[model samples]
Each structure stands twice: as C-alpha cells, then as structure tokens.
Target chain A: MCLGIPGKIQSIRDDAGLVMGVIDFGGVQRDVCLQYVADEVQVGDYVIVHVGFAITRVDEDEARRTFEVLKEMSQLDELEWMAEAAEQGMRGLEKPA
Target chain B: MKYLSEYRDADIAKRLIGRIKTRATRCWTLMEVCGGQTHTIVRQGLDELLEGSVEMIHGPGCPVCVTPLEQIDKALLIAAKPNVIFTSFGDMLRVPGSDCDLQQVRARGGSVKVVYSPLDALALAQKHPDKEVVFFAVGFETTAPANAMAVFRARQLGVQNFSVLVSHVTVPPAITAILEAPDNRVQGFLAAGHVCAVMGYTEYEPIAAKYKVPIIVTGFEPVDILEGISLAVNQLEERRHEVENQYVRSVRRSGTEPARALVQQVFELANRQWRGIGEIPMSGLRLRDEFAAYDAERKFGVGGLKVTEPAACRAGDVLTGRIKPPQCAAFGTLCTPERPLGAPMVSTEGACSAYYNLAKYRTADPAGAAP
Candidate 1:
C-alpha cells in the first residue's frame, strides 16, 4: 500500500545533519524528511509525503491544472465548502499555538 | 488536502463518466493495477456509474496481498524472537503468516510495533542499542526509496541493531504477469500513480507496446480515477496502445531520479514470489551484498523457512481480476477480515477488503447477480 499525503513545507531545517522539515497537512503539522527532495523543495513548496519522507515536489502548475479541470467540470462547490471547513480547522489549530 | 480535495469533486466525477460513456464504442474491460485505486473506485461507486459502458477489474497490486506467504512466515519467525523489536505498517500486523499473524505474536509476548515510516524504525534502532530492530519492509517501488534511505541512514550511523526484512516489489512485472495470463481479460490498464511518480512511465511504454494495451498512470482520487478510466476508454476506442499520464501533477516520464538512484544503490533485482500468484523473475528488490548487514533475513537466518497457502482461498484469481472478491466460496463466509483466509481480506488497500468494506451487500446473496 503506497499511502502518500500532500503537505506544505512550513519550515525546513537540518536535524542532526539530515535535512528535515515541518510540514502542514492542511491543519496538522508533522516532521518530514527532505532527503529525496532536498534540491527541489522550498519552504512553501508542497510535497507528497510517503512514509515520513517527502518523495517528490508537488508541481504548482500541475496542481492548479487539476483543480482547474475539476472547476471546468463544474465541481468547485464541494471543494469550496471543504476549503472553508479546512480553513476553520486550520484556525482552530493555530489558536493553540 | 490542497492537492487532494479537488480530485474528489462529485460533479467532475459525473462529467468524467459522461465523457467515458461518449468515448466507449464497445465494452472495454480495464484493470486498475493498484489496490488503492480499487478502494476509491468501490468507495465512490465509480464502477456503478460506468456500468454497461465499461468493465473495471482489480489488479494484483496490493503489496500485502501479493507478498509471498513464506516471507510473512519469515517475518513472523523474526518477530517472535527474543530481544527483537519488530516494526511494520499498521496493515501488515493483521496479515496472516503461514500459521499466525504479527498481532498474535504480539499478543504472545512479542515486541511488534506499527511505525509510520522505516525512518521511525531507524530511530528505534538508535534508541534501543541493546536489542535488534527489524522493520518488515513491504511495498512496491513507491516505498523503495524510503526504505532504501532508511537502510542507507542505518549504515551511515553504524547502527548495527537495525535491519529490514524486505519484500519490495515493482509494478511493471506484475502488469506483464497479468497480460501474459491465458485468460487475461484486461484490454487496458490504469497504472498506480505513486509508483509512476517514483519509477516514471518510461518502463510502461515497452509493456504497453508489447501487450498492445493502453497503460494510463492514474491517481487514487475519485475524479482522477474517472479521468483515468476515460483515458483508457478513449485509447480502446482509438485502438491505441501507449502509456499516458493522467496524474501529470506528480508524475513525469523519467520519475524522481534521486529516489530511484537511492533504491538502485541499496537494492538489486531478484525473483520474488507473489502469494497465490507464485514467483516472477526480477519482480522484487533485495538488499545488495554491500548492505547485507542491514538485511534482516540474513541477520536472523529466516530466509529458508517456507509455507503453503490454504487450498480454499482463490486469491490468485481474485488478484488477477479474473473474478470478483465474492466469487470465491470462502469469501465473506470463511474469509472475513477478522479471520481472513487470504491477505486480500487483511490489507485495507486490498480489493477483497474494499469490496467487503464498501459493498458487503453483494455477499448477502451470491445468486450471480451483478452489483
């Protein structure tokens, strides 16, 4: 089972000589390794995190195109609804910090 | 959720279905080569939507389901050993070995733990220097990079206690195996997107050309799968056999070179046995001789132990998309998730598990009725 989730890199740093980062999975944040994507990833760049490692950098244009295709198919309403909820969830998470 | 939420749009799924219906000239049987794709298809009722227009079959891509029975038995033996901390993903703990599962071993006083990553297992080795830490590495090319990095890190740190019981597999071989089958009904394939992300679609070109089947690298979301199906249908109608990328957002023609390099550096190709499906030459990744110390099989001496699958289970047929999960006499009766007769019933990504979890009503009465 190849279980990978998209996460945005919140911060990047070296942890004991290994490149690591704090990634935000929507609202939740966790530590991820940048060993595989060290050259391509930036602080704000999105990545596909699989098994604690950032396997590849998520292309901005491709991600936008996917959403745009869905939008063209008249499917943004549900995504809009979810985005609001996710934003709220992120706010809720931020309140603690 | 950023790259994920938009792919599950219901309206997009409907539109994709409409496109697939328009493109379909005749019935085309398409097989999705990933258990993750199967789960999404069942959960989202995509097959029901494309009913009569196209036939979607599940492939032998569930790593846990296809992992050889003897390998599980070896993992069990190692897990049961004293002063050994066994680590694996949550799914593998429930998968049955020859006689018992890792959960049973844990219940009987074994230190089997579920870890999110092989890196976590590496951390376990660092923290527990006195004990042996063995990560049951089970997955395909999608996971090889991560597992390879873990072993690489272990060697770099000189972590003598760390080792991995590898059962790594690749996707193209499995596709070839399916296409080579005598009764193979798959005209086109929806390749696993993540595997393509790591290994790219280059390898698929030859397979598609050789088999005269369209191989579309697809993602796991609802809309993504629908689009993938639509692409396959278009190919079938046009009589085209080529590798297309429906998940261009993540996949490329060449794939992630660094990850592939890491995997190639740490592992060498080997003949691997697929449970129910038997062995396929050069289908699996094994630790190189240079990294032999990090190999748990060699470290624990459990590579020779072997076992046979139960006679009643027809997971072989189910895995190859020859039949649905409920077609087996033991399905839902003798092979429920709680007491699984096969690995397909155990892993969450498994086709049998997906059918049972999302569409168990199909099992209530098996009168040969189509779902």
Candidate 2:
C-alpha cells in the first residue's frame, strides 16, 4: 500500500458525487479517485496513485529533470571510479616494496 | 513504465553506489523509515555495496509490523461475530492475532473478505443493508486519506452499516522516538517519500533541526535510495543537518492539500501502542468525535479487547533496529513467515519478512563485505 505508482490519466468522470477517472498504468487501466487531485490533474497528466486514489499529481518537467541530474551524476562518478581503479592497478604493477 | 524502468537503470545505480562510498569519510548509521525502501535496498544489495560507509538500519514504518497487538485482538473479536462481514487488505488476513488470524476466522464460518479499497467495503455495506461491513484500515499517512474518504462518504451517503477499525500511524513521531533513544547511533534518516508525498516534509523540518540529523525524503528504488544516501552522506561530512527532498519528482514542500484536509476532518492524533514497541504519544490516528459513530471499535463493542506480545518474539528489538532479524534466537527457528511469532514477520513490507524472503540474494558474508 505504501508503493504508490505513477499513472497517466486517460479520462475523467463523476461517479455519483465523487470525481473519478480511468488511469493507464503501463497499458493496464484502473479506475482511480481523482477528487483529491482534481484541482491539479487533467487528461494526459501523471499522478502517483495508491489504493485507487490519486494522492499527488506528478510533475512531468520535474520527473524529467530529476532523471537527467541523476543520470549525469552517476555517469561522472563512474568515470572517476574507473580512473581511480586504473591508478591502483598501475601502482600494483610497480616494483614491490 | 516511463517513470518506473528508468529509476532501476543498473549503470546509474552502480554509479550512485560509487558516489556514496567516495563521499562518506567514515561509517554512518542511517535508517530508511519505510518498509518499501528496505525491500529495495535489500533486494538490490545497496546496503552491502556501501557496507563500511553506511549502516542502513530498517525502521518501524511498516504499518502491519507496528500495529499494536491489542488492535489485532479487537479485529479478531469483531470479525468472528455473526452477521458482521470483516473486510481487510489481502495482507492483513494472514497476520496472527491472539490465537488465530482472520483467515482462521473465515475457516470457522466467519465472513471475512479481502478488499483492495475501503470503498469496496462501503459498497458491500450498501448491497447488504442487513449486514455490517468493517474495514481494517492500516497504513501510514499514504493510506489515511483514502480511509478517511470512505468514512466521510459513508456519512454523506447515509450508509450506517459501514465502519472502520483504523490502525494508522505517522512517520515524524516515530523518527523522534528513535532519536530520543539513549543508545541510538542513527546519524541520519531516509524519510519515506510516499508518506511525505501526503503529509509533506514540513513536519520533518523541526525534527532535522532539533535532532541535528539529515533527513532526506527518499523514494523506493535502488537509484533513488542510493542518491538519498549520497545526499545524507554529503550533509554529514560537511557538519550540516537538514531535510532535503531526494524525491522531488513526486513530492512537494507542501503535500496534497485536499488529501490532508479530508484526513484532518475525519481523524485526530491520539496516543497509540505500536505492536512491538510501546506507546508513543500522539503517534497514531483515530476517528474524531464528530465521526465516532463510524469507528468499528465503538460500533461493535470490541474496543475493550487487548493482548500482549509473546515472550519468544524479539520483534521489539528488530523493529527498533537494535538488532537485525537474524540476530534473534527465534528468527528462523521459532519465527518463520509460515508461522510468524511477531507482527514484522507477518507483512511483506516488514523488515523481518524482507530479510527472510531476500536472504538468498544477499552475499555470503553476514558482515557485508566492502564494495
């Protein structure tokens, strides 16, 4: 229940008195309660859903930015580790003390 | 899968691991407060990769693990009654009460149903007007709004037959309690992101300043967790302690306002007893006076039920991070998932169950060899 999934809103409707919508998770569609997030979401927007309720609307720009930053930082660190490892290997090959 | 698969990219995870290892000057004890994060960390061996640099102590954030035994006993008492249909999330059925679980109650002719949502139970109540429908509402703040909505809608629709047995807890106080422990070594925390996505990180701000520990609101993925660790390590290395948002994509400084408003309307904070750990002041949520009629404990008259933890279970120690699950004498011998001696072993999100389920994936060295 703690693992909320980010799903794209496919359509919106009012079920009786509550605001509801069909959200597409990957390809599977599940009806979700959108009343909590009605003010912030629209068709094609992404929201983090838990137990059939949309808790918070996902920021498309923010999501892309976070991934970009992480990707860049990780790549930079990978190069640093490789350089450190190469220096260590060179030292290992030097004359034994 | 746009947001899902990218976070699990292996190259990025490896790099984050290397970054965290390089950043930390010495071993730092940090606790990930959500069971979901624990599962990711253990499954990906993130803790082992940063072994010497970080000690990831699993916190008591699993609602099923921390739900007081007395509440379980009350649920059992209410579930076994005639004409009352007990509805709960699938996981709660297997959790053992004093002598039997909800499944056993169903085995003995009780009407126990597993529901994915509280609205389903409300629907059942509407369908069978003659019977009463009770939902076992259990989770952190991530779940409270949905449960509160059910109650709010029930009252609005004039559905008198639906009620809930709420066992909801919050994260900030739990962090406070862990910090106040005299022997605590936790220098930082990876706050559960989903919880903050509901309650926001504002509550954690005071906690970070007062305790002087970096609390990074973290997501439930290998790369997210590794980045959260790296962020916390950087703060500690520089003698800085603050609440930072590692999960900026899903969470905001102020969480969803509509959800919070509904929860505030239907529930209020109360002193609650954790299943293994003792009572923490105002750590749990309960129905407000206006909505007291929707409380199952009040409606069914099972509120007086109580039970104590078994002497053999070392769950208290495990839940508080004093010892790992395997450190307990009864970890494997007396407390298997098939027959859990304590609450932590009962839920998949639980740290004990996480240890038991993912033990094979872990490296041979229990001490966690350096990366």
Q: Please give the distance, in angstroms, between residue B344's alpha carbon in candidate 1 and its true position after superposition.
A: 1.3
- A-chain TM-score of every model: 0.61, 0.61
Instruction: Report the backbone clash tally of model 1.
Output: 0
The collision pairs in model 2 are none
Please report the interface RMSD of model 1 to 1 decimal: 9.2
Instruction: Tell me the DockQ of each model, to 2 decimals.
Output: 0.25, 0.19
Give the alpha carbon lDDT tens digit for every residue of B121-175 in model 2: 7877998899999999988999899999999999999999999999999988899
- What is candidate 2's CAPRI-style docking category based on DockQ? incorrect
Model 1 Cα shift for residue A89 (angstroms): 26
Model 2: residues >4 Å from true position, as ranges? Answer: A59-97, B1-8, B361-371
